[model samples]
Target: MRIFNEFTFEAAHHLPHIFPDGHINTRLHGHSFRVRVTLEGKPDGKTGLISDLGTVKAAFDSAHEKLDHRYLNEVDGLETPTLENISMWLWRHFARSLSGLAQVGVYRDTCGEGCEYAGEYEIERKAA
Candidate 1:
């Protein structure tokens, strides 16, 4: 079985690079961010517990507090705020801080469109 929890934060950022002329990102922009974390593992045979929710929550809380309503590009290693890149970066952040994390999803808007990653992730564009 799997257990899941979620966190929300707001942040601002822009790409300083990658443009028609290879210019940095555009001017800084901000958005409300949502992060969903899921954990999957078998319950302990003796304890009947996969993992404690408090443990995961604590880690997520710390991460969110640091990121909420801040300039994401100002944070080292996060110079871009694109949904796909942010999703992958978030997954790595949580995986390092929390144990048993199976996957992560990042929502950048109200619509269902967003990015998701598990373990190592890569974003690809498909032909429509």
Candidate 2:
């Protein structure tokens, strides 16, 4: 069985790497970012549910608190802040607690454009 939850956060970001080319992404912009967290696992016999919605929501809430109303480029793991990077950052952030986590989807807005990270590949992080 699989379960999913959605959360929204507002933040600003600019792609530094895209600046030299004068891409629009180089200018600071904000989005009502939407995140979908998907978890896959067999249902528990007692509860007959894959996971508790409240528990999953609370975990996402804690993670979203750090991103909401902030500048994405300033966040610890999101200095570059592309859709792909943001999704991967979220996957790492919630995977430990949500062991069954299968994927993370990040929507730039209500638009269909976004990115999904399935945790199928390793992302090297810069040393702090």
Candidate 3:
């Protein structure tokens, strides 16, 4: 079974690296962001549940507090604030808090854009 929880935040950011002197994305702007964390696990024998919904939500409490109403550029490790980076940042911080963490998603509803990511692994491939 799988479970997920989400939270929203309002923050400002700019894509300073995008070229063109007056490119709109290069300008500082605010967005309402929705972040989701997904976990995979089997239902427990006693409770017959994957995990408690409240616990899943609470696991993201630190993330909500850090991202809400802050300038993304100023946040440590979020200087760029792209959707992909945001999802990765959430995964890095909240992975340990919520067991079975499988994926993360970040969305900007107003812009109809989003990104989803599964955590990376250091794969060691054998030569044929």
Which candidate number maximizes lDDT?
A: 2
Lowest-sum lDDT 10-residue window in model 2 = 16-25
lDDT, candidate 2, 20-116, per-residue tens: 8678888888889999999899998998988887777888887888899999888998898888989999998898788689899999766568998
For candidate 1, the C-alpha RMSD (Å) to the true structure equals: 5.4
Best by TM-score: 2
- Candidate 2 C-alpha error for residue 16, in Å: 1.5
- In Å, residue 86's CA in model 2 sits off its true spot by 0.5
lDDT of prediction 2: 0.87
Between 2 and 3, whose TM-score is larger?
2
Candidate 3: stretches off by over 4 Å: 121-128
TM-scores of the models, in the order given: 0.78, 0.90, 0.89
Q: Which 10-residue window in model 1 sums to the lowest lDDT?
A: 16-25
Candidate 2's clash total is 0
